[model samples]
Target chain A: MSSQAPETTQIHNIGYRSYDGPRLGRAYARRALFSQSLRGAYGLGRSAKSKVLPMLLFAVMCAPALIIVAISVYTKADKLFMEYTQYAVYLQLVIAVFLASQAPQSVSRDLRFRTVPLYFSRPIERVDYVLAKYGAMASALFVLTATPLVIMWIGSMLAKMDFAEQAKLFGQGLVSVAVLSVLFAGVGLVMAALTPRRGFGVAAVIAVLTISYGAVTTLQGISYTTENTGSIIWLGLFSPLTLVIGLQNAFLGAPASFPGEMQVGAGTGAVYLLVVLGLVAACYGILMRRYRKVGL
Target chain B: MIATESLSKRFPRVTALDRLSLDIGPGVTGLVGANGAGKSTMIKILLGLSPATEGSAQVLGLDVRTHGPEIRERVGYMPEHDCLPPDVSATEFVVHMARMSGLPATAARERTADTLRHVGLYEERYRPIGGYSTGMKQRVKLAQALVHDPKLVLLDEPTNGLDPVGRDEMLGLIRRVWTDFGISVLVTSHLLGELERTCDHVVVIDGGRLLRSSSTSDFTRTTTTLAVEVTDSDAHPDGAASLRAALAAAGVTIHAGVEDGLPGAGHVLLLEAPGEETYDLVRDTVAGLGLGLVRMEQRRHHIAEVFKATDQEEVPAR
Candidate 1:
């Protein structure tokens, strides 16, 4: 054997201390994920490029209300040109665009980059991830639906309308916003979660909203010509927007606005509410199942 | 710090992990294997991100099936692939991760800043991660894993795309993760040579089966062949030939052409040195023959030699 001596080395101390601090468990995890996802839905914590679409779409939702308010205040008109409850329906395309663009911002990007592994490796459960995404999407839609109503309220004050009538309309419009937010948010997030590709997710959400509207209008046209009343009540169930409007009309004791819903009597508010709950539950179930297998 | 029992995972047509069991203590351990060796699968099971098809596992004494949330709260994971979202800055992403691990809001920001600096990311942490280089992206991924100060970190192929210099830097940082912070680490790599210098122990596997698990020194045992060279001089002409003859006469087998044409001898002689006495016998035999011993040393095995140990028999995982 060759004669060689063993060498010894000393360890140096470069300080990196252990953390013995408090680590709150599931409740904190839930709140943190929920808040971050809510901000992400509006592109708050990301680059400027990501903020462009949501900001533009939000502006588009407010433009018509602002212009009508300006004309009334300048001319001193006595009545509003547009009702707050009907604005989202008249500009359903813009609302659809907002949902299509923003839903994937929270769900598809995480899937595309495989960032779910980072999320699932934390203290949160898989269902908690799904719930956070749902809450964020619903809140964003609620903001979009409610902002125009608030603008109309401010315009009513500027126009010097009767305060009691305006307050009643505002409360009625908010009930519509609350119901529609849950309905549209459920549909948008589930489609994005299932597709998980941005372009296809966009197409799928838009298609779900528009295609259902088309089918409802066609069935309503057929019923209008035939004068068939029973088929008209059932056809209102196909389109989510029309279905929500029917609930608003039924509960507020207002005249029906859409063509298809005028034939259905105003006594079916309980059935409409049940269908709304069922739709929300179904979408929630699918989203939760999608995430359970995502991190694996 | 980690334990598994009869763990098996199967896809529709393939079994990823087959009855693999391992018990690892607190230190830096390397899981050595080739591609498709079920290394990622085993790590996911340990973290409780994925359930095993059968059997049981635990991390830091929490059962994988019943206590996944608690286990995940304490263990950090650096996944093998590119898993970072491209639109957010590193600071934003790491702070979110820290908060997700149950740190309070102010502490999350503080820990994120400290972790980014520790991972060698300074001003660049403010830029979107989509514009960063592969090495920079890797550092961000590594930083998020450590932001929570977990008890153990399971890193899957941390040096997959790094250059030689970047690889060495990452390996040094991993070693320091254990030494400076006293956290346990289980790192995986398909390449075996790199782990020899970094890991205190190594567990080798193939085709979803455990082949061997032992300390790095034990797996790299001293081999039986001794390489001997003698100086050819005036006092002893043909020194290599005389030593070969003398060692053979002293009841040692000599392979006459060890590196047959080395410049110091006409040929280097190889001798069987299985015990300490055999080394002494070689020195005495060469001295008696009046030949100069140039060099004589036992051959040390490489990590590649461990692959052949699988063919000998199945070794239960330790």
Candidate 2:
């Protein structure tokens, strides 16, 4: 390793040392990116101001469950006041706001600042970065969607409800929350990825979430009032929240969280499940294409 | 440590690299080119961040196509553009970058501190990068590239936006990356003159083509011009003119040197120093003219002269 320059011309000692330790390689790099993204979702490693919105939304989401617990304990009821599977449905706006504000924290900052090239230049591949960000968003959404159900489950026990019935309902709620997490994460990340501006991404995600739910609910209200059974049952397929509720109602025998007179059959529930999986796969496909087009 | 064979990259609008071949061994090598002359494009290809449209390349004996992750594991890169997140502290960012290179947590933090200190960022490393001076931001960029302790580092325009003093300090740090830690460096710059002082070998490219590649010593070997400067006095307002006339009268070759200002401020006289006797003749000539000899030295060729030679050849053919 002799250089053309004279070897005697020594460099000053800055205590520079070469690393000879074991390098963990690609899998480790992917995991590090995932953990960083997850922490970033809740503003854990960022400034205090960044922590405000996500934490506030989270507290707002859990407020109703806490209040219900207080009411149940005061009354000394035989059961918890609220259904576990229907908790997220009642506070869907809170979950939407959380997803809108935090999704950009996980994905858009890197794209906007053009730091995506730095990640791509590392040992990890392009898909690893997309997957890590997607996974973090989904995990964060899962926690947001599931925390209230656990609180209500605890409240059910405190209210002296039957353990077997409450645990079964809690498990069903967990399954529904997991499905909702994946669906919302896919949709939120795609919207965030579409725009590099954080403000615009937030606006876009909130608009998509609100507009789709608003339009579907309005149409379902009309169909239910007019007694249009066919349209009422199928209209729930248009929005992510309704889609998960339809799947839950059909497969898990959970009580309907839907609007008037809408009943989701087993076959319709199967279709809802397929659409959710298809939409998530499409989001991942779009993310891969987006990163590929971005030059190093 | 890097070898490329007929590497060429083409876009729909223009070609960024064309049939460029090079063999760079251990030490500091400077890739000289103008802005958009394929310097960044070439570095991206070498680091396997971008694929070459034609031909093949290898870094540290690993093919860029099949073994990109393997090559990137051993080769570090600092991009030409600003790629840092402004909200994070330098230590925080560098540690994350080190972890991205697959160093464990404790190792990442230790190396980040060491690398930041080596790059001359001390207390400032704790501050958010948005508040940093351009020079400090550049240092953070360099620190991350070196934090992983790769075997080779490809630095793209490491002195892009710095004052003269900052540029020198950065160049000194780049040199130390090789001299201190035994890491081979391939640094790129649009300015050719700066690399002449720091690089052992220099490669020049233009319009996506290889203009010239040679050791820095060979590129800047001494020319035959002996530069002479004489002091100005009231008796001889233009001593260089008097010395030039005297030297020509003595049958010595002469050429007009670069003029710095008004003629009276002691201009340089370029004399042909064919042999050792030319120095003696110049000394005798200055004494005969009753002129004070300010300085006499043989001029060495500059790395910039390579482009000048090429430009001169191209103008006539056109």
Candidate 3:
């Protein structure tokens, strides 16, 4: 047999060139985003069915709502079917729980298990990872909360309700899901980013969603019962859930508006949505910076 | 090719790597260090996963700090910990990982199969990794790293929790990764001996500092010491005793007691040879006595000795 080549080779003597700075950064970011999307798709579509069965169970339970709309349209309950548009408010609560359960684990799992290093080793950027995670979370929440709402809207449409009334409810449902999903996604991302441990992250999400919001709502309730409308609206701003609810109540024509007899205008509600968006953006920025510093 | 210039990393309360500089060329470069000795830190920095607090590092002529993705795409990593998603099978996981690395679906599946087979995991690849033994899990990790067809692989403690047989198998597989596929490997182990046998070059670090970095041959080279073994005869009850006495009387610097048994049988003696001529002299001396020369070999410095020398020099600051 011919002699084998040398087993060892010498280090190449070559001058180093500076990295293509912009290109490197972009590539890193792109990889991060792709990985994040892949992770979300896998977790939500594959894993979450077992882990977050309650969300799926809720979806199953909502089947009766569809049948009710069907029965109402086909028979004597068409008006009740039209009135059922108000139940769109319940999707917000479902979304709150869905977002709360998933947000804490998204980034926290990587940190807790020390898998961040593996992620960084890939051709993905830190910013992309954060954004991808956020996007994935938002997508999951949308599926859980928005999908059912859309289905219900379609069922209402198929029930042959008045076109004018159907148009009004459909517009409201779309806006409601958009605002609520974003809010839930924002809170979840912030809470998850704040802690490396999944348990603590989950607890933080629950605390912010339930206790903090509950406290604000309770104080607002007492203030409103005492006819202190200004206190109700200000306190309502403290909880996105309550602000959405307050807006919904205003839209559905409730008497004695919470913001001191002032009508709940779309402008003020838009400002609340803007504030929520701002908070989400701020949280995203913080998480991205933190993950960048965290090596593996 | 990889190079680091005083690369350092400091945690909140501890410094993991402290100004370590080394050049790693093609072929397998074994990074040997005890737990918490900055082996993982160095790998992370090279992969651009972790940034160094001071100094710079480059891999494949690309800066690690900014060009992490480009480096990672070209470098595969088999992490130290068990990070497999418990529910996914090795095939599924590796394929998914390959796809994440930008492989097309068909190519990812094909590459995954090829990589798993190369790592010696065939039918077992179908089973979820959670049920796999530590060795099997390790092989899956290796398969995933290779699935994307990276130019270099950084394997952190690949044989961390394997039996002797499994460790040997893993080392052999690592060697094949380089020899068969031409993939350069940067494998780490706390055991220096393991690396000495498998790596082309060895890098030793202690307490986040570079103790030594050299070719395996250079690390093994030292003053010549010969071990001679002779088959014990029925007439000569203690063959090693006779050989040691005869060698000692012949002006050979015999060290310590004669070790019982040859390479396969009989008794052996340790002799310090002054030069290469001593080997011929010892052979003639043993054969001149009409004794069966079972084995005669030169002994190199044991890797443990180097660690001992470094350990005795200074106690690293925790």
Candidate 4:
């Protein structure tokens, strides 16, 4: 059966090289963070239809409110500055609601689905994951937080409102949005970090932002009525919204509203900024540490 | 190449992976363990998806703890569970994953198409994965893992929910992923037989601890026991019992007969032989008895033998 014999093959020289160096600790962390952010972009792009629908819906809903504010500023050109500033404050409330709805889901969904392992397996460190997640969520929130302020500024200029007043309000709004974005991002990160479940994170964020603040303000109001004291001045610092409102009052030369009295002071604004910074720092620290220890 | 040292994982009540150490080299390495045997945990630790409570691991020369991403970039992973987004089509999801691994947009798209075709998805890749069958879904998962063209791939129970035919097909594709593409694979499965034909190395674990880790050949090597089947006839023919007695008288250890469930249903005798010429001896003995020799072969150890051996060892210890 063997008309032709099968020939045996000979082996050739095999070459190999080895790598040696210091362990890639922090460098790997940086790579991991970049990859995680890229993963976030990939995840969002994969679910683009679902994510884009909600974003577009929000944009549509806000369009009418933006137009109304623009029309008011165009018609009453003298008080345009005041109206736009007030409108910005109302827009912050919408930003708060949007944050409450979206931020928790963004963090909690990964935990619920046990998909954090997918991200952890990448070249991204835990800190990088947290930062990437925060960035992704903050980017989403910026749509609501920064877009209205930008619209109002553009609308004011087009309507030919008082240039000096517009400039002042624009500057204030810019600072306000920056502070608000940080505050929202910190609060959201902290709330999501506290639990891996989506429902609990959302509920926790809502409680901190709305229920806890409402209860504290009510208690402060009662204290003001009964004791007739000004020591409760720091009560606004207990809630992020109140903190923002207090800073806004100080910066715009508006009357600062305590429980019983209205006053104006630069000292209160500094205190509010300090408190926001403290919270953001605490939230970031806790979030990074928690993420590092998280199982997946 | 991968190595682990005293790797362990502890939960609140149960330890998912006990103090287990192992080393795996190039080629297909099959991780076999029952559900909750820490196979997934080991894969996660190796992938840097989850950190071990103690000990250390290295994958492709990168530390699992710190350089997980770097390791993951070089290694691909196909998770055991259903983690695919329902809305996205396979082509879109895999392409997006390829890009996420740092491929350019065009390269990602091209690779995604090539991987999908390689996995046999074809036109079905365009359909939303929510409607995919288990086999199709498995292909999508495999496509995503290979789309990045990684050096190694960790496939966690890639044959989960697959029928025997589907399992064979998946196993064939996995072997091709190594042989055809020259990529190393770390595939996990609950069934050892599923991997016996595919993998070069086998690592077995139970109760969160390693039981055995060796080459598949070492585990499946034939033992010095002959399984013989003889034909019983009406004319002057003795049954398996008579043949067993005849073999026993001839200084051969006749362990069991047809009723002992060696191989065939009837006239099969399990003979314990001391040397390698057991098959020839059994054939000569059966021919001398005037009984037709049906089949005589060495009894190869099944993967199930390992489980039985472990059970026996545990019984004696207890």
* Predicted structure with the largest lDDT when compared to the true one: 2
- Tens-digit lDDT track for model 3 on B204-306? 9988999988899887886577878787776666777787788778888887755444344337677888787888888887777778887788778877787
Location of the lowest summed lDDT over 10 successive residues in candidate 2 chain A = A253-262
lDDT of 3 by residue, A1-296 (tens): 34787778888633212111122334434554445454553363245454455446456536656776667767844543433334535444555555555676567766765656666667666766676777777666555555555665676677666767766766665565565666677778788877877778878887787776678868877886788766666676787676656555555442333434546566665665666677777777777778867656
Candidate 1 chain B has its poorest 10 consecutive residues by lDDT at B309-318
Best by DockQ: 2
DockQ for each candidate?
Answer: 0.61, 0.66, 0.22, 0.18
Q: What's the CA error at residue A231 for candidate 2, in Å?
A: 0.8
Worst 10 residues of 1 chain A by lDDT: A258-267
Docking class of 4: incorrect
For model 3, the superposed segments whose C-alpha errors exceed 4 Å read: A1-55, A61-68, A75-86, A104-113, A152-169, A189-207, A247-262, A265-271, A289-294, B8-19, B230-242, B256-267, B272-284, B287-294, B309-318
Docking class of 2: medium
Clashes of 2: 0
- Candidate 1 residue-wise lDDT, B255-294, digit = tens: 6555545565454777788788999998888787777777
Clashing pairs in 3: A28-A124, A28-A125, A29-A125, A32-A124, A117-A296, A123-B69, B261-B266, B261-B267
Q: How close is candidate 1 to the true structure, as a TM-score?
A: 0.87
Model 2: native contacts recovered, as a fraction: 0.72
Model 2 C-alpha lDDT per residue in residues B5-38, reported as the tens digit of each score: 9999999999999999989999999999888899
Considering the two chains of model 1, state its CAPRI-style docking category.
medium
Deviation from native of the Cα of residue A152 in model 1, angstroms: 1.6
Q: After the best TM-score superposition of candidate 1, give how far the Cα of residue A293 lies from its true spot, in angstroms.
A: 2.8
* Ranked by DockQ, top first: 2, 1, 3, 4
lDDT of 1: 0.85
Q: What lDDT score goes with residue B245 in model 2?
A: 80
